[model samples]
Target: MQANSASGMAVHDDCKLKFLELKAKRNFRFIVFKIDEKIQQVAIEKLGDPNETYDDFTASLPADECRYAVYDFDFTTEENCQKSKIFFVAWSPDTARVRSKMLYASSKDRFKRELDGIQIELQATDPSEMSMDIIKARAI
Candidate 1:
């Protein structure tokens, strides 16, 4: 993981590894990430089971904190064919501190760059902004 001189934060090595597992191996349905302010590094906060619902994944995030996440959304296409798309989510809730939001905003690009094969990206400042409807719309 390379450190960003601007934010002084680096993504933990495991972030990319877990993402790869999700991408190539279907190991997890979703992953949540947080920046460890004390260590100044991004760390894996949680991993969702393969069968976890979107609600469960959303519940894992704190109501007043910022986070980064990747979700593997599986759905049937118009032809009834099964398909999956990987979504990279930047979750900076409105209630979170400005500094926290700023840190996440600054570090997001570098963090995302490390994970290869991401298909979609979402940036949300509220739960409604990242709802299932939005996910589905983006996947299409």
Candidate 2:
């Protein structure tokens, strides 16, 4: 993962790839929220396997200024490549602030402490602080 200080944005390419791999494996139900031009929040529940391709996932969403998203994992079926018992919600940076905040707040309540603590810490800290914190947290 990379964090660009000049832009005040964090990049999690590896994490994103891992997430996509997991999603493809078990077709998880996910919610994506746009945080900004270079930031997104994802949440998942009962993730099974990943079956949807990147193109397929992106195409399903409404075209907007959304550059980042989050989602939950659900169940996957090998026969049809169609996710069963799936539920997803998405938002973009251009989405209304009130709407986005409401969604985030609600999701946070629903997903309280479900995400890894390191991810939560990274979200709460600045870029410079993230690396050290992540390293320290991981060591423990």
TM-score of each: 0.96, 0.27
Q: Please, what are the lDDT tens digits per residue for candidate 1 over residues 27-123? A: 9999999999888999999999998999999899889999999999999989999999999999999999999999899999888888998899999
Q: Candidate 2 — which residues are off by over 4 angstroms?
A: 1-49, 63-90, 105-112, 116-140
Question: Least accurate stretch of 10 residues (summed lDDT) in model 1?
Answer: 1-10
| Clash pairs, model 1 backbone | none
The residue-by-residue lDDT of candidate 2 on 37-102, one tens digit each, is 325334222222245543344444444332223333233354545433222222343444555555
**What is the TM-score of candidate 2?**
0.27
Best by lDDT: 1
Candidate 1 lDDT: 0.93
For model 2, give the 10-residue run with minimal summed lDDT.
117-126
